[model samples]
Target: MDYRVAPAVRIAGRCRVPGDKSISHRAVMLAALAQGESRFDGFLAGADTLATAAAFRAMGVAIDGPQDGSVRVQGVGLHGLQPPAGALDMGNAGTGMRLLAGLLAGQRFGVTLTGDESLSRRPMARVIGPLRQMGADLAAEEGDTPPLVLRPVAQLRGIDYALPMASAQVKSCLLLAGLYAQGQTCVTEPAPTRDHTERMLAAFGWPVTRQRGRVCITGGRGSLQATQFSIPGDISSAAFPLVAAVIAAQGEVLIEGVGVNPTRTGILDILRAMGADITLLNPRDAGAEPVADIRVRASRLRGIAVPPELVPLAIDEFPAIAVAAACAQGQTLITGAAELRVKESDRIAAIASGLGMLGITVETLPDGLRIEGGQFRGGTVDSHGDHRIAMAFSLAALRAPEPVRIRDCVNVGTSFPGYTVLMRGLGLEIEEA
Candidate 1:
């Protein structure tokens, strides 16, 4: 499928994006391991999250109704998960696969994890190396990619490991494994990544300790207690329309109930640095995460040098940020984002190529992109089968002189199921093609 987005005269409205994908995945996984039935409101009923739910169901956990963002997960306890009938397919969720590797490592029965083509190519060595350090018998296909196979280990011994790079997925994977390891597992990160796992672990009644740049958990020390939670709106999904409001010629947009966790607010900070008129309203706690309503108005954006320290925080939202940069008044220099190359797609290259097609001057770099602010000339761009790339370009259409056609956008449903409808509701001239 493709998306054909036409120029918008105005972008104005109040809307709420889907629930946070990362939190939804963790909620389901941790809930399944808890001792009672846990109910979740505002869950993201997207393909990737549903895949995680399905995997748990395959292992004999009963999951009901991700309908209307409501789901109920019956906990089977940490040691109660039954062996699956076959290889567990994670679809396109790299988060699900990596975290599951850790969660399943200490189980008595062996398991295999597979994914769709895109996920199958993502590097798994980061999680694998840490799991190996804890004595997990895990292996992957060549290039440390997926088709991950694991064998039962007599015991998993926890180790204090430092992350070579900041990764929430890797950190969460190891911590999940720590739940069953023989001793305390401590992970120190070089920089802060998302703390959803740590927070969710604590919410599930698992004891997790946190200090500056470090999180530690002891194996078999506590059991997960099933608890109810209401997931906040995904800032990553809210990013596209937020950028739309920034670059649109006229009007304001309010995105309500968004997760504004400090670690994941890098996108807002970067856009603000670029002169985006964004504000947070009604700030409050939503379960274990922070929630706020974000208000943005059309503003004259000026591209600025993106700080490297904020890279990990805004990692997933860079694609939309690139669109904002393309429509800004000056050049935007992005660095310390080498991780973008390993995402669902080579985002740096994909965005660069897409912007170039729209008559934007973009210099592709190994770690990032040098994007020049300029007018967008409508054109067709391939999404490289990446959901973010597809949505980012759709937002660019708000500032285009003509319609923008984005190819290979079928994957958008993996994260945001009703993207076209949601964007259209906010006055973006978008539709499925």
Candidate 2:
């Protein structure tokens, strides 16, 4: 599948993107471990999130209706999950596979977790090393990549470990495993990452303590309690439309009910630094996360040196940031983002390649990219089967003189389903081909 996006004339409307993907994944996982039935409103029904729900179902948890962003999960308690019939396929979700590995480490039965090609290629050593240190009998296919095989461990001993880098997935994985370990497990990160896991853990009645950069949880201390939750709109998914509104020839766009957690607002911060006219309205709590309405208007963007400190917070949205960079007035320098190399694709290279095809001057660096602001010409770009790359290129069309054709876009549904329809509703000239 591919996307053909014509030049956008004006981007004006009020709309909402899908629910936060990270929160949706965690919601389903934690809900399945809680003691009773939990209802979730605004659950993302995308392929990646559904894969998490399916994995729980395979382990005998009953999950109903993700229809219209509503889902009911009947949790089987922390230790009540039944052994699956076979290897659990996580499809395209790296988050699901890593977190599930931790949750399943202390179980009595053996399990194997696998994924689609892209996910299978992602580095798992970050999560694997800590899990192994906790006494998990697990091995990856090539020492670092996925297809994780785990044998039942009679007991896991928790340890205070510090991450070499900041990673929400790795931290969350260890915390989940800490739930069953013999002692308290503490993790310290050099930089702060997303705290959805910590917040969700507390929401489920699990006691989690945080002091500065460290989060700690004691094993066998408490049980997860069922609770209702309402997920906020994904800022990652909202990035494309936000960039569209920023670079459009005319108009303003209001994106409602978006998650504005301080940790995940790097994209907004970076864009604002680049002179994007973005504002947050109606700030309030949506369950454990913060929600707000985003108002963005077309503005003259000026690129600047992106701070390395903000890299981890905006890691997933860099592709969209690249589009905004290309539409800016000067140059944008990105660094300290080596993590982008291991995502669903080599995002730095992928973004550079796609932008170059559109006549943008982009110089690829090992950790990041040096993008020069310039006009975009109509061209065809390959997404390398990465959903974010595909969507980012689609947004680039808003500033192009001609239509942009993005190939290998079949994977967009893994994160954001109904992308074309949603963008169209906001007046972007986009369609599936």
- lDDT per residue (tens digit) for residues 1-433 in model 2: 9999999779999988999999999999999999999998998898899999998899999999897999999989989999999999999898899899999999889999999999989899998899999999998887578899999989999989999988899999999999999999999999889999999999999999999999999999879999998999999999988999999999899999999999999999999999999999999999999999999999999999999889899999999999999999999999989889988999999999999999999999999999999999999999999999999999888888899999999999988899999899989999899
Please state every model's RMSD to the true fold in angstroms.
0.8, 0.9
Question: Per-candidate TM vs. native?
Answer: 0.99, 0.99
> In model 1, which runs have C-alpha deviations exceeding 4 angstroms?
none
All models: lDDT?
0.94, 0.93
**Model 1 lDDT, full chain set:** 0.94
Predicted candidate 1 versus true structure: per-residue lDDT over 113-216, tens digit per residue: 99999999899999999899999999999999999999999999999999998899899999999999998999999889999999999998888899999999
**lDDT at 137, model 2:** 96
Model 2 root mean square deviation, Cα atoms: 0.9
